[model samples]
Structure formats: structure tokens, C-alpha cells
Target: MRVVVVGGGIAGVSAAWAFAAEPDGRPRGGVSVTLVEAEATLAHHTTGRSAAQLIENYGAQALRPLTTTSLPFFHEPPEGLTDAPLLTERALLTVGTVEQDEAIERTLAEGRLANPTITEIDGDEARRRAPLLAPTDGHRYVLEPESADIDVAGLHQAFVRGFRAAGGTIATVTRLDAARANGSGWRVETTTGPIDADIVVNAAGAWGDVVATAAGVEPVGLTPLRRTAFMVRSPWDHESAGWPLVADAEHTWYLKPDGAQFLCSPADETPSAPMDAKPEELDVAIAIERINSHTTLDIRTVASSWAGLRTFSPDRSMVLGPDPDHPGFVWCVGQGGTGIQTAPGAARCCASMALGEPLDERIDPGGLTVDRFR
Candidate 1:
């Protein structure tokens, strides 16, 4: 069977790796995989622009299972697949003001449900974990020690190496024009050439619905929200590598230590059409103001900034299986904010439905499958 996976982002690469490998890292029988990317290089879009975090309690409730399942892969990747560790120990600190008491409760409840080890902490401890929060008023914090900082590039490359080593073909500068049924299989037209495949995986990020529509399949409602992030010089007088990822309990903004600097975001979720997203000046300015008001850092200049689209379904959960209406058309999109953290389990699920493998024991194929949209 020939499997064509669209998009070369983290989700697409993860799915391709599964199709290209046996559980033991050998080439799977009879299944040939091809990963096609529209850009000149892989992960030039949302995948490359991610904040690169591995917070287990993040995203929709149904999606938390995937995060837990992906931990092992991030912790101990396949032998010789990655030269360095994909994850590093870093805490997730969520703080709230007295006015946001309900938001704090909701965060704690959701976080504890996913990771029972999460603990509520007083303002002093919050400030201790991140000294920048020292003077912030009306703030309290909850700590999820299990969360960590992920090496985004390293993790993405591991899958790429695995896929290539398994004899999978990667086609860049190949934009999918459309795809349609050819008997029991599909004939996909691209900018470079045509590909005939037994199945096609739609991992097209924000272009998910567009790809579906081109293939004569009904479009799933995937709303892409733009999230802007920027870096500012760490205003701390001393080293801050020991700090945790600090996010507002109201979900308004977040900042984390990065080398000698700090990465911050307004957590903006503006509705957007499918395209290459760019950071708006206003979004950057707003994030700076929020970060300044919440912390001791009086950020004045942005070192760099960028934006990426976080696509979501109507329910804000991922769609990761064969489309109910068209079995040949599989849905592996709608990652929202959980793309990097949940890629492994989501990919395994997509590969099974595409390659006729059994469902992975780690994943709960409950509300995440594409059948929910029907």
C-alpha cells in the first residue's frame, strides 16, 4: 500500500514515521510512505514556531491522554534516533490574581486531573520559583513539576531520521493541488507531480479544511487561531536559568526563561484564514505591557517575534483518524496548542487506521477520532 502524508510539520512527520516503521524500527511490510511538504524545507510553519513546551495538563480533556502517552517517547527515544535528550527538567508555574480566583480553581482542577502531582502554592513560593514574580500583586501559583521544556528541533528531527532510515521518501516543494478516489485508492495531484496511494493523511495544519474540500470531501470546521510570541532581554540582574515557565492563570500571557533571555506571548487567539501567519506589532506591544504589569521585567525592546496558527475543531480537540464519510481520506489535523506534546500518540492512532494496525493501548480512541465530527 502506498501512503501519502500531506504537510511536513511535526504532526505530518510523526504520522509518516509510524507508517514507515515497524514497532521495532524495521521497515514495515508492503507499505511505502511519502511525506510531501509545500515549502522548500520541513517545519517552516507552525512546527518550527512552537514554544516547545511539554506541559502534560495542557489542552482539551480528551487530549490529555495523548500527552501522557507521548512522555515515554520524549523521555527515551528509539536507540540511535536522537543524539541528545528531547526533554529537560523545567516546572510549569501558573499564577493568578485574587480577581481570577475562579480561573485558578479551574486550572488546578484540570491540571490535577491530568497530573495528580500538581500542587497549589502560595505567593511566596511562586515568587521563589520565578523571582520575577516577586513584586507582582494579588498573585498565587500552582506548580506542575512533571511538565518540562522540550527541545523542539531535536524531537522533530528524530522522527525525520527514523522515517528516512526506514526508506520513506520525502518530497519538498510539492504542494497538493487536490486528491480523488482512484478505485479503492487515491491519485493525488501536486505541484511537482502526481502520487497514487492507497490512503492519504490530511495533516495540513491550518489548510486542513482546504485539503479536504479539494478532495471532494466535506470540510471539517477547523478554525485557525493566531498566537504571537516574542523574545526580550531578561531584565533580571542575576542568572534566571532556574526559573519555571510562568503563565497567567487567566491565560492572558506567559513567559519562560530562554538562555540569557525570556520568551513571552500574549496567548492571543485571533481568528484567521489559512496562510503563513506573521506576528502583529500590536500583539507584541500588548504582550509586553501584560508581562511588565505582572512581573518586575520592564521589557522595552523585542529582540525577535513570530506567529503561528493553532488550528482546532469545533470541540477544540484533535481529529486523528479516517474520515467517516471517506475512509480513504484520513484526518490527522486540529492540534490546537497541543501539537508538539501530543504528536506521538496522535501519529500512532493515525498510522493504525491508515495501515490496518491495531489501536495502540496507550491511546483512548474516544472523542479524538474523526467520527465525532459526523
Candidate 2:
């Protein structure tokens, strides 16, 4: 079988890699995979623009399993595939106010499901973890110690490398403009050339529906929400790093420590389309204001800022597997904010479905199926 995987982000790369590799002890040549990307390079969009943190129990209840199943891959990537580590020590601290105490309790309970390491830290403890946080506003805290910063680029490239080593083809700078149902398969037109495939995996991020329409498949009502992130100089001139990722318990804003700098986002989720995203001035200003109010890092200037789409289904859970009405047209989009954390398991699930095999039992198929949307 020949499979054409669309979108070269983390998802596409993982699917491609899995298809070419001997997944679940499946025999090789079960499927020939070809990954296509519109951008000149893979991961130039949401996958590349992620905050790159693994926070268990961070997304919807149904989606938590994907994040859970992905931990092993992040903690221990395949051997001989990477020259550098995929994860590093980092913590995610969710702070709450007096009025939000109930919500905080609920969040803490949820965090316990996938992260037993989660613990209630005192305000002083929270402050110690993130010294810049304002002491007065700190009312409650829950620390997800298992959460860590991910090497997104390395992970993405690892997939590409594995796919190529497995004899999978990668066509960059190629855009699928149209598709026709050719019997049981599809004939997709791309900028580079036409490709024939027995299956087309629509991992097209924000352009998922467009690919669906191209293939004469029903669109899943996928909506892309715009999220903006920026980098700023650390409050201290010296390396003021080692700060745990700090955020409002309600996710109003967040700041993660970077080398000699900080990555901050307002956690905004404005709706947008499939296009090159840009940072809005007001959004950046609002993020700065929120960060300043929550912490002692009174950053007045921004070093750089950019935006990316966090696409989601109507139910807010990922829509994986083949479309009910169109089995050959697979749905791999609608990852939302948890894409990076869940990519490993999500990609494996996608690969299993594409190859007509049972899902890896290790990967819990809770909120990852298309049946929910049906």
C-alpha cells in the first residue's frame, strides 16, 4: 500500500516514521509512506512554534491519555536516532488566587491522574521555584514535576531521519492543491507533481479541512485558534534561568525559563485561518501586563514575538482515525495546545489506523478516536 501523509509538522513526521518502521512487530513493506509539506522545511508552523513543554493532564480529559502514553518516548527516545536528549528538567506550576481556590482544587485532582508526582506547594515554595512571581497574589500552587521542556526540533528531525532510513520519501516545498477520488484511492495534485496513493493522511494542521475538501471528504468543522508567544530578556542581567514554567491556574498567561531569557504567552486563543501567523501588538502588550502583575519580572520591552494556530475539533478532543464516511481519508488534525506533548502517541495511533492494524495497547485510545466526533 502507498500512503501519502500530508503536513510535515511533528504529526506528519511521526506518522511517516511509524509507517516505514516495524511498528508493533509488523512486517516491513506493509505500506510505503511519502510525507508532503507545503513549507520549505518541516515544522515551520505550529510544531516549530510550540512552547515545547510536556504537562500531563494539561489538556481535555479524553486527550490526557495521549499525553500519558507519550511520556516514555519523550523520556527515552529510540536509540541511535538522536545525538542529543529529547527532554530536560523543568516544572509547570499553576498558581491560583483566593477566589479561584475551588478551581485550583479541581485542577490538582485532575493532575493526580497522570502525574502522581503533582503536589501542593506553599506560596513560599512556589515563589522559591519561580522567584519572580509576586508573593501577594499567590494563594495556591500545584507542581507537575514530571513535566519537562521538549527538544521539538530534534524529535521532528528524528522522525524524518527514521522515515528516510526506512525508505520513506519526503517531499518538501510541496502543497496539495487538489485531489480526486480515483476508485478506492486518491490522486492528489501538488506544487511539485502529482502523487497517487491508497490513503491520504490529512495531518494538515490548520489546513485540514481544505485537504478534506480537496479529497471530496466531509470537513470536520476544524477551527484554528491563534496563540501568540514572545521572548523577553530575563529580569536579571545574568542567567536568571532555572525558573519553572509559571502560569495562572486558569491559564490566563504563562512564562517558561529559557537560556538567559524567558518565553511568555498570554495564552490567548483567537480564531484564525491557515496562513502565516503574526503577533498582534495588543496581544503582546496584554501578555506583558499580565506577566508583570504576576511576577517581579517587570519586562518593558520584547525581544521577539510570533503566533501559531492551535486547531481544534468542536468537542475540543483530537479527531484521529479515518473519517466515518471516508475511510481512506484519515483525520490527524485538531491537536490544539497539547500537540507537542501528545505527538508521539498520537502519531503512533495515526500510523496504526493508516496501516489497518490494531492500535498499540500501550497507547490508550481514549479521546483519540474519530467515533467521538461521529
Candidate 3:
């Protein structure tokens, strides 16, 4: 079977690799895979811009299972796929003021349900974990000790390497223009040329709806929301690398230590079009203000800034599996902010469903199949 995967982000590469090989890393003999990217290189958009972190209690409830299922892969990747571990120890600390006590309680309950390691902490404990936090009364916190930093580039390359090793082809600077049903297969027209495919997986990220429309398939209302992140020099001379990622309980802003600098974001989700996103100066300034007010880190100047689009379905759960009206048109989009952490399991499920196979027993999508959108 000939399978064509559109997009070259983490989602696309992971899906292509999964389609070309088994979980044990053995190449599937009967299947041929092709990955098409419009950009000059892979992961040139959202995947490249991610503040790569794996938080077990993060993202939509339906996606939490996928994140859990992907943990084994991060802990022990397939042999020869990567020389180093994909995950490094890091923790997430969510905090709020007395006004947000309800939000903090709700988050703690949901987080502990997903991972028992998630626990509530007192104001003093939260301050100790993140010294930069301003000492204030009625502060609440929740810590997810199992969270870690993801080696995004390494993970993406692992999938690329595995796919190439399995005889899968990748076409860079090749954009999918349109696709039409041709008998039992499809004639995929691209910017470079045309190719035949038995199945087409839409992992186009923010452009998911556009890809579907081009293929004459019903678009699944994917909304792309822009999130801005910026880096600032850490003022503290003492060791700060051990500090956990501190975030607002309401997700108003967040700060993570990175070497001599700190990565910060306002956690703003502005609606955006499918394009290369850029950080607005206003957004960066607002983030700095929020971070400064919450912590001792008086961030004044930004070293750098960037933005990425987090695409979501109407329900915010991922849109996976084949479309109800188009069996050959599979979906792997609507990752939102969970794409990196959930890539392994999500791709596995996408490949399985696209090939007409049953989902892996370990993976439960929480009924996030594309059929729900219909």
C-alpha cells in the first residue's frame, strides 16, 4: 500500500515513521510511505518553535492517555534510533493567589487523577521550589514531579531516521496542492509532481482544514491559536537550573529556567491563520509584566522571542482516525499543545487506523476519533 503523509512537523514525521515500521522497529514489508513538506526542511514551523516539555497532567483529558503511553518511548527509545535519552528531569509548578483558590483546587484534582505524583504544595514549599516566586499570602501550588524536558530535535530526527531506514521517502519543498479519488486510491497533486496514494494522512498542523478542503474532504473546524514565548537573562547569580517550571494556575504566564536565561510565555491563545507566526511586541511586554509581578525575576529586556500556532478542534480533543465519509482520508491533527509529548502514541494510533488495523491495547484515545466531528 502507498501511503502519503502531509506536513513534516513532529506529527507528520512520527506518523510516517510509524506507518513504515512496527513498534519493535522492524520495517513493514508491504507498505510504502512518503512524507511531503512545503517548507525547505522538516519541522520548520510549530514543532521547531515548541517549548518542549512533557507534563503528564497537561493538555486535554482525551490526550492525557497518549502522553502517558508515550512515556516508555521517551524513557527508552528503540535501539539505534537515538544515542541519548529523549527526556531529562524537570518539574512543573502551578501557582495561584487566594482569588484563584477554586482554580487551583480544580487543577490539583484533575492533575492527581492523571498522575498520582501530582500533589498540592503550600506557599512556602512552592517558593522553595521556585525561589523567584514572590512571597505572598494565600498562595496555592500544585507540583507535577514527573514532568520533564523533551529533546524535541532528537525525537524528530529519530522518526526521520527510522522512516528513511524503513525505505520511506521524504519530499521537502513539496506542497500538496490537491488530491482526488481515483478508483480505489487517490491521485495526489503536489507543487513538484503528482503521486498515487492508497491513503493520505493529514498532519498539516494549523493548515489541517486547508489540506482537507484541497482533498475534497470535509474540513474539521481546526482553529490555530498563536502563543508567544520569549527568553530573558536570569538575574540570579546562584544556580537556578534546578528550579521547576513555574506557571500561573490560570495559565496567564509561565517561566522556565534555561541555562543562564529563562524562557517565559504569557500563555496567550490568540486566533491565527495558517502561516508562520511571529511574536507581537505587545504580547512580549505583557508577559514580562505578568512574570515580573509574580516573581523576583524583574524581566526588562527580551533576548529573543517567537510564536507558534497551537491548532485545536472545536472540542479541543485531538482529531484522529479516518473521516466518517472518507475512509482513506485519515486525520492526525488538532494536537493543540500536546503534540510533542503525545507524538509517539498519537502517531502509532494514526498509523494503525490509517492502515485499517486495531488500536494498540496500551493506547486509549478517550473516544477522540474523527467520527465524533461528523
Candidate 4:
């Protein structure tokens, strides 16, 4: 069967990889996969603009299972697809103020559901983990030791390499204009050219609903939310590279070490129309102000910054599996901020539903499927 997967972000590439390979990483039989991206390169959007961390205790409860399912792939990827490890040691540390006592409790409770190893740490312990943090009287802390830094580019590249090795086609700078039912399959129109496929996977990041509408299907009501992240000079000791990612329990701001610089984000969730997102000046200013208020680093200037869309379904869970009304139209979108961490399992589920196969026993797949919304 010929399957065309839209969007070239991590999700698209991973979905293509899933369709091209068996669960055991062997090339599948009787399946032809084509991946199309509008940009000249893959992962030019949210996939590339993530915080690059794999924290199981994130996103909605429905998505935590995907994180669990994807752990093996991220921890031990297919051989020869990567030259370096896909993940590294980097703990997630969430701090809280007295005013946010409820938030801290909620985060602790939610975090434990995803990882039983999650535990609370005192302010002094948190300070040891991130010495740059300004000591506060009422500050509380929680640590997810299993959380680690994800090599986002490496993971995406691995998917691309594995898919290509399986004879899958990749079309860059190709935009899908429309799709229509042709016989028992689909005729997809694109800027690069037209193609016919037996199945279509809508992995389009922020433009998921757009892709669905173009295919003559009802929209899934995906809302693109803007999240801005920026890099600033390191203000701590050189060895501070081992510092855990420091974040507010309220999620107002977060900063993590990356080389000699630290990546900071306001964790803003402003609604926006689907498009190539750009960082807002106001958002950057807000992040700097918050980071300065909480940390010893007086971040006055930024080295670089970018914004990406974190699209979500109406209910805030991912929309996977085949459309109930149109089995040929499968959804692998609505990842929100969990896309990078959840890519592997999300892609696997997408391919399984598209090909009428069963997902692994570990993933329930019931909560994540498109039928949840129906």
C-alpha cells in the first residue's frame, strides 16, 4: 500500500518511519511511504524549536502513555541510525513559591502518575541542583530524576535515515494543496506535484485542521498556541552545565543549561492562527523579567530567540488513529508541547491505525485515538 504522510516535523518523519518499519525495526513488507514537507528542510517548526527534554511527567494524562511507550525508542534507538546517543542526563526541577502551594501539590501528584520515581525535594536540595536560583523563603521543589535532555535533531534525523533506508520517499519544499477520494484511495495535489496514495496521514503540526479541510474532511478544531524560547549567556560557573532545568511550578518561566548558554522560555500559551510562528518581543521581555525575578542571572540580553506553535485538540489530547468518518484520513497531530517527547509512540499508533494493524500491548491507544473526540 502507498501511504502519504503530510508535515515534515518530527511527527511526520517518525510516522513515515513507523510505516516503513516493523516494531522490531525491520523494513515492512508491501508498504510504500512518502513524506512531504512545505519547507526545504524537515523539523523547521515546533519540532526544531522545542526545549529538547524528555520528561514523562508532562502534557495531559492521556499523552503520558505515549511518553511511556516511546521510552525504549529514545533510550535505545535502532542500530546504525545514530552516531551518538539520543538522550543525555538532565533532570527536571520544578520550584514553587508559597503563593503557588496548590500548584506544587498538583504538579507533584500529576508527576507521580507518569513516573513513580518522582519525589519532592527541599529548597536547599533544589539550590544544590541549580545553584544559580535565588534563594526564596517559601520556595518548594520537585525533581523528576528520569527526565533527560533529548537530542531533537538526532532523533528526527534517525527517523529520516531509517525511513529512507526502507525505500520511503521524502519530498521537501512540497506543499499539499488538496486531497480527494479517487476510487478506493486518494489523489493528493501538492506544490511539487500530485500523487496517489491508499492512505493519508495528517501529521501537519499547526496546520492539521487545514490539511483535513483541504482533504474534504471536517476540521478537528486544532488550536495553535505560540511558545517563545530564547538563548542567553551563561551567568553561572563553567561547571554549571550539570544544573537541572529550573522551572516554576506555575510554569510562568523556565531555563535550562545548553553548552555555555541557557535556553529560557516564558511558557506562554497565547492562541494564534496557524502559520510559521515568530517570537514576540513582548513575550521575550516577559520571560527575561520573570527569569530575573527568580534567579541570580540578570538576563538583560538574548543571543537568539524563536517561536513555534504547539497545537492542541479541543480537549487538549492528541488526535491519533483513523477518522471515524474517513478511515483513509489518519491523524497524528494535536501534540501541543508533547510532540517531541511523544513522537515515537504517536507515530507507531498512527501507522498501526492507518494500516489496520494492532498497536503494541503497552499502549492502550483508546484515549489517544480520533474516536475520543467523536
Best by lDDT: 3
Alpha-carbon lDDT of model 2: 0.85
Write the residue-wise lDDT of candidate 3 on 315-373 in tens digits. Answer: 89899888878888999999999999999999998888777788767566556787776
Alpha carbon lDDT of each predicted model: 0.89, 0.85, 0.91, 0.90
Deviation of model 2 at 182, angstroms: 1.5
Give the TM-scores of the predictions, in the order they appear: 0.97, 0.96, 0.98, 0.98
Using TM-score as the measure, name the better of candidate 2 and candidate 4.
4
Residue-level lDDT of model 2, residues 234-342, one tens digit each, is 8664456777888888888999989889999999999998888998999999999999987899989999999999999887888888877877888888899989888
Residue 178 lDDT, candidate 3, scale 0-100:
99
Whole-model alpha-carbon lDDT for candidate 4? 0.90
Candidate 2's TM-score? 0.96
Tell me the lDDT of model 1 at 213: 92
What TM-score quantifies how close candidate 3 is to the native fold?
0.98
Per-structure clash totals for the candidates? 0, 0, 0, 0
The order of the candidates by lDDT, greatest first, is 3, 4, 1, 2
Candidate 3's displacement at residue 53, Å, is: 0.8
Q: Specify the poorest-scoring 10-residue window by lDDT in model 4.
A: 358-367
lDDT per residue as tens, model 4, 1-374: 99999999999999999999986678997999999999998988889899998888888887778889998998788876788989898999998899999999998999888888899999888888898889889788999998999999999999999998888999999999999988889999999889999899999999999999999988988999999999998966467788899899988999999988999999999999988899999999999999999999998889999999999998888999888888888899999989988999889988887787977776777778777777
